[model samples]
Target: MERKLAAILAADIAGYSALMEVDEAGTFQRVRAGHQELLEPEIQKHNGRIFKLMGDGLLAEFGSVVDAVECAAALQRGMAERNAIGSESNPLQIRIGINFGEVIVEGEDRYGEGVNIAARLQALADPGGICVSGKVGKEVGSKLAFAFEPMGDQRLKNITEPIACYRVNFDRGSPDRVEPHLRNGYPTHKKTSIAVLPFSNMSGDPEQEYFSDGITEDIITDLSKISNLHVVARNTTFTYKGRPVKVQQVAQELGVTFLLEGSVRKVGARVRVTGQLVDGRDGSHLWAERYDRELTDIFAIQDEIAHAIIEQLKVRLLPDEKVAISATPTEDVEAYTYYLRGRQFLHMCSKSYMLLARRMFAKASEIDPDYARAHAGIALCDSVLHSWRYADVSIETILATSAKALELDPDLADAHAARGLGLQYGGQREQAAAEFKLALALDPDLHEANYFFARFFFEEGDFERAAELFEKATQVRSDDYRSAVLLTCVYLALGRRADMKRAGLLGLERAERELTLHPENSSPAQLGALALAYLGERDRAKEWAARTLAIDPDDLNAMYNIACAYLHMGEHEPALDLLEKVIPIASVHRFWWSTDPDLDPIRNHPRYKRLVERTTLASP
Candidate 1:
């Protein structure tokens, strides 16, 4: 072997084996396509030579460290774009590490401490990030205009001195660029973000849709109980209803770190459910299983599913979360079926459906008044009715109903969530926060609680906490289009430019997809407008905004978002003009104006100040 000084590049799929197992042919095709189309071209463009390809990993050598580092960044950005539409079970993500050191080069491969160190550094990189050893950093420091964050010192497997590392922050041509902070030259930690897609209904009878949906809801509820995990809520998950979606797109739209998908089938007295846990970073299946059981053992089946997931994810179930699962309303199959039906209607989020849900919950409660879950269902329905202002019911009546449900069973997280929403709407901010906290304590997997907490944090001007909670909510339910869109706003508030761009692009893709899938829906059009605005596409943003207003003139969020778009584009006069029209409706409804970070650009403007003062006086 000939020893040579080189800039060694090491690259690997974050979760290769598991992804291949999930869909060997598909994963192989996508990964190979990415390697040939993007990675190879990038390396060549930067004057780097591919030394070898070892299964899902590769080694390359470059004469210049700057070129090697730049190539890694470009490759990752392209891969992320490609993976946006691929299957989550085999996502096209690679971790790249660069080091400047001596390597023993053979005919077609390289080896030595330099190669090993680069490989190890790849392991330390985030899914779409680059990690460079100190040697590489020092060599490129004066030559390139790249920002580096020191990760301190890392102890490699066989290296003597601690290897200092630096993370390259992706620069997309903005003066106010944000660099990723690192501890010891490596990303210190990663949040556990997950998206739980809707479970497929495979039962021969179409009427069993409710049963299958209930199973998905239960799994989501159970998973949200893990405080360490960010579970997307049912509202978000159900957005993918009746449409085929690739797992990678699901992960990107939801901004999740992981993905959970499953199918449910019921046959007469027997039910069968299959579930698989996947790593979103590279579409790897961490665990998969099928459960077969009788319909009479519905609660037991739910418990088994929850336990399997907990074990697979290695999440520690808190004592209270464990106890909540076992606290079922006896083994009454009829009552459980009624409760499931109620839950299905409740998830529909329509007034008529919720009324039907209330009747089903009443029947379940009548069958067993001591059923805490049934009471929780009633509480949820009442809260929804109150929120929608159905039949002009008093707020007091809604709160009372929610309180009764909680009184019947203090451990019912759903009841606490309902009460929290009711209290918050009734202007009891402190009590609402406390109730939300209690619900979270009772069931950490409660998506509603997490979502409300995110909103609370945003309203309190705590953008960092809001972003964290929003991220968690997305993880619990990956298909939630609203949360996915809202997260872009959170990223903007936190000044995470790369994250903002990634999220904005993901939201735009999802919104466009949704529009194509459901052409008549106005929401997606509005979301597309917001995304376009964030991306600095002023004309396109205005066009989409106009389309949204044409569909629904009274959409305050859309109206406000349009105003924000103008503000971001530096069209202050038009922005103020739109804001003047929006302030009245926002004040009347107290609709998220104070918490909207998009309005930051116009916050100090004289027009904004006058509008706020006028709205405050006009508000009741």
Candidate 2:
């Protein structure tokens, strides 16, 4: 083997397998045409040669880093133009990664860390985009017209050291167009970012876990108020709960500059909170503090932590941001405690948990009638319970509680989101849209706002809008599987077969991760079954379906979701049987029954038509 320094360019068709599954012969022909008509000519024109082809991907070597970078940009631009006019249902897009490093050349092919880094960077690139290591970025800097967006330090799989990466932006001259560089639809933050991991429960009681979790979430929320700082959402950060993690590893995975982790202990009438902020780049402590105070000073402790972080980071807090950060939700510590427990239950995402969460929120409201966040929590639980057909909560009650929340704190994003959900369920689409818009305007990163808004669009059969919002929801809360799973339906409806398959794969991956943490939580299994069936894992899908059913034989939401999975797996009779039981109880979101893409396989069947008609007649 001859060792040489070369610019390695790796390119692959995104979701090639899914495209082939939809139309085998047509996909093959498209790939061949792309290589012959576009790829080969572009590489040769830029003084490069394709050394190896790996099914849907190819590895090419260029003499200069400039030629490699320029060739990648041109090839991607060409693919975009061709796909713009293509008649195929699935658009053909390629992701490229370029690295300038040493390679071991054997015979006619290249092998080494250089080629490996290029391949991994290709996987990190967005479909129809390019990613390059810092070496390539620096070597080709200002030598080309293309702009580069830094993606932070990424720890690629099996690589010893972290790599600085950048995404190649092709539309630098076109201000009106937005060609986003995404990794599985998750947006990259190019700002000062931090993730606050779940605080350790040092109270030595399992029941006190909620207190620590709540403290972590509140600190995250408080930090998020600063417009200059990008705070990772609770859903994504809490995934690290109870796990032994390395500071640099967590930062690399989360793509953040800093990590905040600590412990919370509450013993009788006293509370001790210890927090430390670490610079993820070098795992150096930027700040550390411990607060020992009365239980009633919990809010003060949270405020001090938030202020310490702000001061350490030198983030300029606006007047409104400071007020928002230090503001206490409730004066009564007991009410706050109950509200935190309610939030913990709400995150469980089950019928029983929803009921328990609602009761806890109700108790909090009863204790402090003017507590806006508590009332907002009640509205959310009621909306979810009523929508899932789990409880007999009236729409009037949802509207009243949400309205009371808004009356108390109109600027609260959760209150507006809860109000919007209530209005959407009450058949007031315009008002709901307004509420959703206002909620998002107040807090663009709020998961509930994005999730509820996406549901509104999905029910209206606006697949394009729904997909965009669902993708945003998944990005805001990286650990959420529901939005990713729902994107499978929206993408399928829009005839984005490759996107649909990618979403299903991502949803299943996240669901599997959730199962590792909460093995008995059947919601993940229920959703995972649908994603599995979409990916053509029939037996595994059936296994997951059986597990979900065994966990809750009479759960309406589980039965409905599993029925969708059954349809995907070609079990029409069983799907129809489950739908027969679910349709009658689906008092809310009747439109989901009428327009679900999963039911299209059996839509024309006599039994399916009858079930739809029965639900239509039963609808008020």
lDDT of 2 by residue, 266-384 (tens): 99999999999999878999999999999989998899999999999888888999889978889889899999999877866767778889999999999999999999999999988
Q: Which one is best on TM-score?
A: 2
Give the lowest summed-lDDT range of ten residues in model 1: 180-189
How much does each candidate deviate from the true structure in C-alpha RMSD? 17.4, 9.0
lDDT digits (tens) for residues 1-620 of candidate 1: 58989999999886566567678898888778878999899999999989888878899999988789889888888988787866564466788888999989787778899898998788667667898887876576444555554443554435667686666766656433433232232222232556677788898766688787877877777777666555666756676767888776566555455778888888878888888888765788988888888878777877787787677767666789888666565467778889988876664333456778888998998898777778777766776565544435565776777777767777778888878877776778889888988997886556777777777767665665566566556545443344556667777767777667766776787778766755555667777887788888889988987887776676555566666566666677876777787664555433444545666776798887887788788663
Q: Quote each prediction's TM-score.
A: 0.50, 0.68
- Model-by-model lDDT, in order? 0.71, 0.83
Model 2 / residue 262 / CA error / Å: 1.5
Model 1: lDDT equals 0.71
The deviation in Å at residue 208 for candidate 1 is 6.7
Report, for all candidates in order, the number of backbone clashes.
Answer: 21, 0
